[model samples]
Target: MSSPHPRLSARQPRYMIVAQALMHDIETGRHGVGSLLPTEAELGQQFNVSRHTVREAIRRLTDLGLVSAQAGVGTRVRAQRPVNHYALTAEGLSDLFRYAHEVALRIDSQEEIVADGALAAFLECPPGQKWLRLQGERFVRNEGESIGLAEIHVAASYRAALEDTNRPDAAIYALIERRFGVEVREVRQEISALALTAAQAKRLGVAPGSPGLRLVRKYYSSSGELFEVASNIHPADRFSYASTLRLRPTGESEN
Candidate 1:
């Protein structure tokens, strides 16, 4: 049995009612970074209000940087950017990675390694090809939460670029583009079910073997050449991906 969600009474102004509920969600981190917010239709259905009322509520939230809308993408939770689009992206990766490093997220190791299996497939080179591996760990910034571990596998050729501090920034791909003239134009990631290792659990502040999001990402260059591959372990309850998709009228007729 579960308790009901808190809601303003029907007697109150509809916009105020919806706005309050949405604010509560933001304050509680229920709609944190990468959280795709419910659609106007969904909110209207949930609040038993008209779409116009829902729109006004959304507008208020948007003004607060708690929500954002794209032309084709309806609305997504603004990523870590306290202003807007907070989540880390290709363009923002350098800054976020630099911030993480500045905030004492340590880089454990950087070395050369030969990868086989799926990692090989993602890097798209012959098995045992030399790759530059970067292993780093992130903490909660203030609290010692030990967020998780990060591992990036880049071509050996990128090592020099990453080591160049004079470059734009330290994010591996960002450095590759600015220093080595390599541009990552696209990326694909895969998430697999996994039990956390003791080290991961300890770092994530979770029990050993706890379910986590094991992410594998393949980044490609502007020439459509595969450039880097990365594997990350994120606490399941703490990590998520959100995308906003606009809904077009199904009954509409096109010229």
Candidate 2:
């Protein structure tokens, strides 16, 4: 008989396997939005694991926002949306672009605009200065449903760099880096709850007041000057952000 696959690592448990199986069921249409999962006791017996183990597995899925539980009504499946595991760090900087290109998403628009107050203040530029604006909508290639939208603005000095390649699918940073030898060395980000503006909703084709993700970013060059400001809107069903924090001793220097 073939040897059974070795048990999962002692660190994270087989929660990943359980999570995967559940995801497959959801993906293949066996279970769908609002579908309820078997009870904890039933799931433990089904997976041949203890109730505690089952609870951990369920918690893993919950953290990803794929499942919800009611006190007595069992866990129900949430809308099956893209589970984008991303880091708000330099290493993961290319994820948004990757999502657009790899998914064969269509870009909606790209242009240059003069910044008004909020945009001017955010980019630390004076009002009416020319700023390169890249506005685009991305949707699943075959599905044809709008997945998200990105509004990116950068210094107009990079205008020539974007001469003819400003498509909905263009990578703004790539063009700047290639032409002006400017690399986006670091990105600082802050996330907050933002209600969609009427125009924002119309551009994205979503109802006004629909939940969305507000990703505000400042991109810095090697010299540490902030040169780009962007606000990306992701529908509540389209994304989830993840991060980890480590605590240090109180008296230790953060050097």
Candidate 3:
């Protein structure tokens, strides 16, 4: 086995620290692709942790596409570096807000525009309405690679709400609410499949014509007024959205 890694700080979870150390070993080639990692018991002994902790660490590696584990077979290093796979499990509006907090947006450009016929149709607003459009890439917090490109349009009245776009801690809609006291009562979302254009592929670091997903969300206020429209494009390989559906009890009426 390789030399034991130095002790990690207690600030983070134990499994995460163990996972980080193992990931470092893989990236440094100490654990080559196709080679089996140290057994759970061995890892536990080396890290002075429980076998359960070691297992959880390996699970984290598996989630990142770095390693694979099979019954009766040791975990094998699948890749030298972590794959940038982002999965969002949205069950409610709060979950959507949580997703926004998990990803940081880096705005590339901004402009004030009057919605033309086509743009107005997309935004579900009347033609000639003014909007503040912001374009950006969304990254997993503290990671370098971007997972998606985002285009957001805010009603020109709330343009001032975005004055602190640099703040990654709050969602844009939340900012609008805090600034203008307009509550977002509903969010309508649509997902569509598309082949990425060359320009989009260049910005997203994917091949032209790659399969992708476009997600558009329309935010509405309590009075049934649309205030914001946001769209995000994600490479098929990098992002997945999941939702849970529960079956109603028997005899439950559709109405």
- lDDT by residue (186-229, candidate 1, tens digit) is 67767788999998788655679877777677888878877787
Angstrom error at residue 250, model 1: 9.7
Q: What lDDT would candidate 1 get against the real structure?
A: 0.66
Give each model a TM-score.
0.53, 0.64, 0.69
RMSD of 2: 6.4
> Candidate 1, 8: how far from true, in Å?
18
Rank the models by lDDT, top first: 3, 2, 1
Whole-model Cα lDDT of every candidate shown, in order: 0.66, 0.68, 0.87
lDDT of 1 at 171: 52
lDDT of 1 at 45: 88
Q: In candidate 2, how many clashes are counted?
A: 0
Pitting candidate 1 against candidate 2, the one with the higher lDDT is 2
Q: Which stretches of candidate 2 lie over 4 Å from their true place?
A: 1-21, 27-30, 63-65, 79-106, 137-147, 166-171, 183-187, 195-212, 221-226, 235-255
Candidate that beats the other on TM-score, 2 or 3, i.e. the better one: 3
- Angstrom error of the Cα, residue 44, model 3: value is 26
